[model samples]
Target: MMKRIPIALYFLLAGLCAAAQPKKLDIVFIGNSITQGGGLQHPLEEAPPVKAWEWLKRAMPGSNIQYSNQGVSGSTTVDFLPATNKLFNNVVKAADAFKADKDATLVFSMVLGTNDSAIEGPNGSPVSPEQYRLNVKAILDQLLSSYPGCIIILHHPTWYSPNTHNGARYLAEGLARLQSYFPVLDAIVAGYRSTHPGQVYTGYTGGFSYFKKHPELFIQENGRSGVFQLHPNAKGAAELGVFWAQAIKKVVGRLK
Candidate 1:
């Protein structure tokens, strides 16, 4: 026979539960050319990356959040793993400078696979769907293994290239296939998180939906007639940033 807990004590315990939750996110943006924020003219030159940072900063201004961009121009899913490995090694060397301080939660925003769809290999070999999926999984696994309890947000690659003929369709199809594989990644991460409990894995596919709704925003200059460029323009980047921010915010809320 247990004694009944007082209502005031229950309220005090609830407050303590909320207080014990984690705070302070340290997010790393890792990806290809789009993440590098390329091709926007002066004044708008930093628009792409800046837009993303601004959104995050606004959301958690006082959360001790730190955002780092590890994007590289012309990178694909296959190229990114090596790049991150090098960065993580450097971070390990400069542990004080690179490692997240206490109270910091790690998060990774990844957008890749577009270049793999566009470019052919040395022997003109296109990256097969299976290879693309494997590359994505390797990247996620590496990050999760390195940073225990890290939160990963896997984004679908955005569209570029006009008329759907010049490689856009190929990339779009690759993204679709990538989306199908995300549940597998989620399941893997979910199992890992159950043991590691603090880890989080979330995904969202907003690329196709946004492009289908806002075609005009991504139009590229073509002397007289505008066309779609392989990379997003200023307006397009802002739109992409908004989609990213909203999706990330939702994930953050759920995790919290």
Candidate 2:
């Protein structure tokens, strides 16, 4: 015959155990076709390689977190700006409507700057670096305000084909975008979190380096339907997911 524990003791023990769990977090991934899982029809459950959420789930099995993919095919940064019908506004407004817990941590994983770098003009300007910086800052400022203390992770999309298969399109566009736009974007993130670092980061997905190394290969290709060099195949996507996961893991480590 064992002695029964007091009811108060049981409640207190349960509360302590629950409190021991890591803080819950909500993560949002926003971007273009790659983030939309390569603009193809894959099984719904087969997670995209660019999504760090699934990676996080595997890495931190015990962690409490919610993740969503708000990516669209062929979307530019403008679509993400806090406008009436855009994704940024929609995400924030819906979160507010749902009354997301004030105590829960929020994370934003943003991948952009691909279509923006398309050389639409003779001068090779799709969206100028300055404008890109402005667009990125506007979104960041809005997010920081809407979800105070949220950590922002900005990703540079993977490599583009080197040849002029599209005519001066992004002839070495991956390198051009990195050299031209990455600095401004980094500066903006740094500016926002000057007082409090670790609130923002830039994740380079190695598209430039990978393409530069394989000078002979013009594209990252998959024989699978609708897969192309500009868009990564499942394997390429998974590789990107690794890069993104590295960036997010740093933030996850800090969360209590």
Candidate 3:
């Protein structure tokens, strides 16, 4: 029995050494109000404090991770394109500190294009479907060029409430429904994946199909018909944040 003590101690020490190595992870989330956290069914409901990245961090305890929420409410893809914001300098330099750490695995998630289709107020103007594609491509090309090894995931935009009375779906071009342009995202990302192969992927969050079946989960406010539902309330956020995190975890797992 005494002789076996040394052998057991050796194995225990090895396990400790292996467990001491920390995994490095970095994530960046980009989009508009939906991505940032907005839209509630009730006028009295408060915003959900936890977002997708925060929920993800909570999910994985004792892991080395760096994350940032770059979501800007009421902003369109044009805000991210050239002649607008300095995505690399602002996003990478300001928000993404992990970019400095060469050893860290980087993941970028984009949930945009909703505001691009807005027709309300002075700022609202729907972008042409083709232009939207080009803007997205520009965003990707810049990111990949900066971090050649980074992993990219395109999140499908959330579904708009069918109730047209609220007028949030007001269109700047085309037949009027702003959500129709969403499918262009799939096409653009699909082409991106084909050329980039394993480095890029599309994380289908089922936003459109989901809310359609479970409209109760969405916030319905404004207008007698109650048509404003481009955002999810606290309950919606929790469900969505969790679902998206699952997709993110899958991609993060492939980092090694």
Candidate 4:
């Protein structure tokens, strides 16, 4: 006959088991048109945020996930600046809602700078690389203060045709400016390593170069300048979603 285990010991063992399980995730995606699935048939269902959440579900079985899409058309980093209280307020509300889930880990996945690089049209078009870095840092500072312990992932914005000119004018010069922001993002993440430690990370650096090589993945639009590729097609959105999910998983796994 086996001896009975003490009640206290039994409860401790159960607690240990629960602690070893995967933690639930609550993500807030902040970006611009591409993130919102601007050219997609049904943005509500086909948006990159939705796709990323779907991919994460399959990739991390048994983990509960929730997300909010805060992408706005024609939005720039300046639009998300803390002083604006425009887009940033909405982002706060979304993150606060997720706070109700005490068991879930909060994460902010951001992709901006597309419209910021535009020569015109966007609110803060032609934003210099220095201003762009400051804007992003300010946004992150407010977010960190508002939601302590939340993870922040800054992604490199994807590519658009050199001739991209519709509501906004992003010619070859604009594309070059967009590329300049990449190094700024890298520096920002590096700075956070010392200040915020593991709370901040650089995410999905491949999109810019990857999309540049595959024009087929993007939808060709009849712009003022002519045909141009900006937003990704459905297949591209799915792939982009996978890219985000991979980066998120890497960060979370590292912390785990």
Best by lDDT: 4
Put down candidate 1 lDDT per residue, 50-122, tens digits, no spaces: 5766776776555555666666666666565535564444323332343547667667777765666643331
lDDT of 3 by residue, 31-82 (tens): 7777667664431223322355566677556557666767666767777774
TM-scores for candidates 1 onward, in order: 0.71, 0.74, 0.75, 0.91
Query: What lDDT, from 0 to 1, does candidate 3 have?
Result: 0.66
Candidate no. 1 TM-score = 0.71
**Index of the highest-TM-score prediction:** 4
Per-residue CA lDDT of model 4 for 1-256, tens digit only, reads 9999999999998766545544799999999999988899988888888899998898777789889999998899999998987999999999999998878889999999999999998998899999999999999999999888999999999999999999889999999999999999999999999989989999999998899999999998999888999999998888998899889988876765
Candidate 3 wrong stretches, greater than 4 Å? 1-22, 39-49, 58-62, 86-89, 120-124, 164-183, 223-227
lDDT for each candidate structure: 0.60, 0.64, 0.66, 0.92
Question: Better model by TM-score, 1 or 4?
Answer: 4
Q: Please rank every candidate by TM-score, starting with the best.
A: 4, 3, 2, 1
Residue 246 in candidate 2, Cα distance off native in Å? 2.1
Tell me how many clashing residue pairs each candidate has: 0, 0, 2, 0
- Range of the 10 consecutive residues with the lowest summed lDDT in candidate 4: 14-23
Question: What's the alpha carbon RMSD for model 3?
Answer: 6.4
Candidate with better TM-score, 3 vs 4: 4
Q: How high a TM-score does candidate 2 get? A: 0.74
